[model samples]
Structures are given as structure tokens and as C-alpha cells.
Target: MNRHLDTFADSIIAGKRLSEGEAAELSATSGTDAFALFLAASRIKEHFLGTGIDLCSIINAKSGRCPENCAFCAQSAHHATDSPVYPLVDEERIVACAKEAEAAGSHCYGIVTSGTTIRKGEELDRICRAVRRIRETTSIAPSCSLGIIDQETAVTLREAGVETYHHNLETARSFFPSICTTHDYEDDVETVRVAKRAGLTVCCGGIFGLGETAAQRIELAMTLRDLDVDSIPLNFLNPIEGTRLARADLITPLECLKTIALFRLILPEKKIAVCGGRERNLRDLQSWIFFAGASGTMIGNYLTTTGRPAEDDWQMLKDLELTAGSCRE
Candidate 1:
């Protein structure tokens, strides 16, 4: 174990990316040394990103009524989860959420909607207007996760001051079909490509605990590494009641921490956030992620899932003495 840690330390110090086998081995590490792996990841994170946490908050601008069939998602029309079905919020309401996020010390505000596509129309226009309003009114960087978009729509978003576009590819190509059927994995790749072409920073990631294997998770990270994603939001599946995957119990806190550490080792310089299921799965040990090379965390409610309140997240940061990202203060 010590010899492997030495090799891992050497690889990170030399700025060399890990092989898939090495990553798989890192995922399989056990016991007290798991904490040692976390320490190594933290060292790499410090060398690159410092102690600043990329604190972000999201508002589900549009919820439910999604047309896709992602088995783990509550918003999917194929499921019967009792989530609020609402149209896109008005520009004023959206702007209000941005204000709230800013007041809470979030460096970025993400406007997320559940949909297959957000093409040019009143829906797109409203979201663009909201982004413009947020940019004009607050210092918070406005971001969107409205699903697949064309080049023209991407350009419109960039022009409206949308700084980042999030579109998670979910999992590796080999494991994607097992999670969702309404959309092909390549379509997601193209969306990120279009967003990049339109001059927007891309934030892409996936959910664990969908019963995917460790090798599959490593493959997903390799794909994100290839994309050069600016931010990776790792979500643990919450298995909300009534969703098709509700009965699935494929993840634990230790496994989730290992994944985060592995992500830090892989995407060392990118902002890696421990998002979603932190409140549920991480249980009492959530704060330890800062030591495990996690440079960011998502606060506030998630789409169709409840999150710890902003005050509790703030207190957590206070307890850890962590600061917001470089841009925040």
C-alpha cells in the first residue's frame, strides 16, 4: 500500500495523468489508507487550487414534466414521482433567485431546467432575459443547465452574459444506455461542443450510485478529462421514492469519498464540486471532503430533491474555515 501511494504521489508530482488501471486501483483502496489517499488528493488540490471552495447554488427554474426517461430522475415523465410541475419562472422571479444566491455568498448562480432541449422560443428568450438581468444586477456569474442547445441558442446565451453552461453526460458510453433511453450519449457530447464553440465554460459531470461499476466511473472521469470540463459536479443518487431506481442502493459514504478523491487526482486543476446527495449519503462525514481534495460544493435545493439550507452550508464552511472561490472575495 505504501509503495502504491508513493507511485501515486510521484505521478501527481510529475503532472502525469493516471492510467485507467491506476485509477481503478485507487478506487479499490481500503481501510485507514483510504484517508491517506484523501490526504494525497488534498495535497494535489492545494498545489493547484488553494483552499478556495467554488461555492455555487442552483435554482430549479423549471421543474418536472421532463420528456426524457432517465430511470433515476424524478422529473422524467416515465416515472410517477410527486414533484411540482411548473413552467419557466418569469424574469423577475428568476432575478430574485439570483439576488438570494448572491446574498448567500454563492459565487455562481445556476438556472436549471429539466428538458430534452431548450430551442429558440419564448422559453429560451425568457431564460436569456433572466440571465441578462442577473448579470446587470449582481456580481454573481449566471449559469444555465437547460439541456441540449444549438449553436445559435448557445450564442444567444453567451451574448446574454451566461458565463457557464452545464450539461452532464451522466456516465460512460458503455454504461449510459442502462440509465436513460430518451437521449443518446453522443447528443450530450455535441451539446458541450456547441457550448464551447459559443464561448461558454462547460461544467459536466455524472451521478454515482446508479449501480455503475467502479471501472465505469473511471471511464466517465476519463471522458470528462477528454472534454477538459471546467467544472465537474459529482452527484450521488438520492433514490427518491416512486422513481424507477428508488430501490437501488449502490453507494455509500466511503465509496463516494473515494470517487471524489479519484476525480481530484484525474481533473486536478478543474473545479470539482461534491454536489447533490451530500446531505443524504455523506451523513455526518460530509465536511471531510475538503480534506479529500474537493474544491467546491453545491448549496441549496436540487432539482426534485431537497438540500440542506444555505445557513447550514454556510456554518459548515465556517467550521472548516474554508473560503469561497477566488472570484467571490
Candidate 2:
């Protein structure tokens, strides 16, 4: 099995795309096999993305009152939660956070909002102004997660100097109905398409541990591979109190590592970042993400949950002898 893993890594380095059966086989690795899997993933990561890690930070520009009920989300209005509720933050506040993120050594800074979609007149204009300012004042690339956006909105953001548009499919198309009923899976897929069509790089991915099966996890990865997204942000589930999955079991740290490795093997050349749930889910194994094939991670607080201090992440990178690479690199 270890030799096979090495061969798989070699094939990936030679530009072979893993088939569903091959990815499923890799997903079932355990014990010693899992260690070999991580090593293989690490080799693949180095070959494609180099040893340097990319760091990204996000500001929740707007919060709560989202109509869509993603089972893992804390900000959805469909479930009562302690998450903050606020309007789109002012342009100055948004740009300020971007500056802070850049100073913290983040390569990409995202301005995220909670809603079905961003309003066009005032809200969109404000975010566009903020993106323009971020481009002018900071070296960090600005991205936006303003919910389901159209081609017009995507182009408008790109024109304002937004480098990437983020929209997660949330889960596998087959399992999406179990997590979010108000919105169809195709809507999220379309958002990725719209962003790509409008000349924006799409950062698309899904959250795991939503009662999805291993097969379903592979399904989501294959879907993203087909979409040909520029980057994939892999989030683990951090069950929030008022959400539907509050009682959901936390996937083991090894499982989280395996998932990261699986994504790296499947999406070999793409920028795969372990975002959100890293601290809570990975626990003691938090530093193993890169070893398990992740090329980057989100360094600051998540949408509603607080991440560990950025200094801690910086120190971890130092301990690993890794440097944070620019997203544009």
C-alpha cells in the first residue's frame, strides 16, 4: 500500500488526474497507510505548490440574517444563534481590516458578508469602494464572498480590483439538499461559473462533517475538479450552538488530516487551503495540515468563530521553517 501511494504521488506529479475509484481508495487509508498517504501528499504539494504556505484572512463585512439555512452555518436566520447581526460595514472599516490582514502577513484578504445576495445600490457600491481602496493601499489581494452573485456583480467587483470571488458549494451536489433546502446546489455552481465567466478567479469549495459520507466527500472534490476553480478552501465543521448540526460528532484529527490529504491528491496542482475549523477540529494535529497536502490556511478569525491569535500561526510557520507565500505567486 505504501509503494502504491508513492506510485500514485509519482503519477500525480507526472500530471495524472486521480479517478473516482483511485480517490476513494486513498480516502480509506488508515494507520500506517495514512502516514504514507500524508507523505505522498506532502511530496505532491512540494512538486506543484512548493514548500511555502499561503495565508489568507477574512473580515465578516456583514453578519447574520441569512435566509439560506446551511446546517453547519452559525449566521443563518433559519436557526437562532448568538452570531452577530450587522449591515455591510463602511468602506473605511473594510479597508482597515484588509490593512490589518496584510500586516499580519496574509497573502489574500476576503471581505465576506452574510445574506442570500448582496444588494446592488448601496451595499455593492460600498464593497466595491472598499475593494478599490484595498488594491491601492495593500499588497494583499482582495477577494469577496458576497453570496450568490450574477455576472454583472462579478464583473463589477473585478472592475473594482477584486482579484477573486468566493462561493462555496457547501457540500456535494447529492448531499446538498440535506444541508440547505432554501437554495439549490446548482445556484452555487452557477455562481462559480458566473464569476469565472466574468473574468474573476473563483475560490470554491465545501465544508465537511455535515453527516456526509466518504463517498460524498469524494463527490464534492470531483465536482470542484470538474469546475476547474482556481483555489479550493476546505473547511471542517465547527458545530455552533444554535445550528442544526450542533450535536454532530467532531471528526477525529486523523480524519481531518486524511481529508486534507485526499483533497491534495485529487486536486494536485490547485491551491488547497485548510480554512475555518482548523483549530477546533485538528486540535493537536493542527500543524500536520501542510504535511497532509494543504498548501495554505486562513490565519485570523473565521466568519463567526474566533481563531487562535495570528501570532500563534506565525510562530507555527516559523517552527515548521515555512514562509507565507503571496497568493499571486
Candidate 3:
């Protein structure tokens, strides 16, 4: 099995794409075979991405009252969770957070909001101003998650010094209707295309463990490959209380690692970041993410939940003898 895994990894390194059947086979690995899979993924990662890893931090520029009904989201107005509800923060605050994230060794600083789409007038202008200020004031690259943006908005953000535009498909196309009903999966896909058309890099991905089958996870990865996104942020379900999936079973640590490895094999050359539920889902095995083929992670507080201290993440990287690398570069 290890030899088979190594051969597959070599093929991927030689520019072969993993088919859906191969990905599903990799997803079914377990026990010692799973460890072999992780090692193979690590080899692929080192080959394409090197040993250096990227660290990113995001500020919830706007919070709560999201009209979309993503089942795993606490910020959705459709769910009665206690996620923070507020308008977009002032430009000063947004720029200040970017500086803070830079000080914390983050390569990218994201300005994330909580609505279906940011308003065109005051909201868009403020975020653009903040992004310009961030570019002028900090070394870290600026990214935005304004949601379901059109080509004009994507162009505007690119002109404002925004390096990347983020919009998640949230789940597999086959399972998207079960996770979100307020919007179509195609909207998110088109947003990625629009951002890319406007000459902006796109960081797009989805959360797992939303009662999705392993095949569905592979399906999502294949879709991402077709989209040709620059970065993929893989999140595990944290199950916020009061949301539809609050009582959903937590994915096991090994399963989480397997998911990471599967994605690495499927998207061998893309920037894969383990974000959101790393602490809760991976727990003591958080350090193993790099070995499982993840090349980056979100270090600061998530959109609603607080992450572990940045010092801890830095120490983890140190312990692993990995250096922080830039995501945009």
C-alpha cells in the first residue's frame, strides 16, 4: 500500500491529475495505510510548495445578520446563534488589524464581512479605503471576502490593492442545497471566475463534516481543480450551537487528517490552508497538518470563534522547524 501511495504521489508530481475514483480510494485509507498516505502527501507538498508554510489572519470586518442560510455558519441570520452582530468596522480599525496581523507573522490579512454581498456605496468604499491603507502601511498582502461579487466589484477590489478575493462554495455541488438554500452554488463559482477575470487571485474552498460523504469531499476538490483557484482553504465543521448542524458528530482526528491528505493528492500544486476548525477538530494532532499536506493555516481568530493564541501557532511552527512563507508570492 505504501509503495502504491508513493507511485501515485510520483505521478502527481509528474503532473498527473487524480481522478475521482483515485481520490475516493485514497479517502478510504485507514490505520497504517493512512499514515503512508500522509507521508506521500508530505512528499508532494515538499516537491511543489517546499517546506515553508503560510500563515494568514482575518478580521471579521462585518459580523452577523448574514442573509444566507449556510447550515454550519453561526453568523447566518437564519440561525439564532450568538455570533456577533455589527456593521463594518471603521477603516482605521481594519487597517490597524492588518498591521497587527503583520506583526504576528501572518503573510496575508483578510478583511471578511458577513452579508450575502457588500453594499456598493459606503461599504465597498470603506473596505477599498481600508485595503489601500493596508497596502500602504503593511508588508502583509490584503484579501477580501465580501461575498458573491460581480465582475465590477472584483475589478474595484483589484484596483484597491486587494490581492485576493475569497468566496467559498461552502459544500459540494450535489450537497449544496442541503447546506445552503439562499443562494446557488453556481453563484460562488461564478464569483471565483469574475475575480480571476478581473485579474485578482482567488482563495476559494469549503467546510467539511457537514454530514457530507467522503465521496462528496472528493467531489468538492475535483470541482476546485476545475475552477483553477489559486488557493484553497479547507475548514472542518465546528458545529456552533443553534445552527442546523449544531448536534452533528465531530469528525475524528484521523478522518480530518485523511481529508487533508486527499485534498493534497487531488490538488497537488495549489496552496492548501487548513483553517477554522483545526484546533477543535485536529486537537493534539494540529502539528501533523504539515505532514498531512497542508501548506498554510489561519492563525488568528476565526470569523466568530476565537483561535488559540498566535504565540502557540508560532511555537508549533518552530517546533516543526518550518518557516513562515508568503501566500501571495
The estimated TM-scores of all candidates read 0.97, 0.99, 0.99
**C-alpha lDDT of all candidate models, in order:** 0.88, 0.93, 0.93
lDDT of 1 by residue, 1-329 (tens): 85677678668867898888889888889998898888888988888889888889889988898999998999888889898889888889999999998998888899998889875789899998888889888999999999988999999999999999999998888999999998899999999999999999999999999988999999999999998888899999998787889899857788889999999898888888989898788899899888888998888888877888889988988998987774332
lDDT of 2: 0.93
Task: Give the range of the ten consecutive residues with the poorest summed lDDT in model 2.
Answer: 320-329
Q: What lDDT does model 1 reach? A: 0.88
**Local error of candidate 2 at 93, Å?**
0.5
User: What TM-score does prediction 3 earn?
Assistant: 0.99
Off by over 4 Å in 3: none
Clash number for candidate 2: 0
lDDT value, candidate 3, whole model: 0.93
Error of 3 at 241 (Å): 0.9
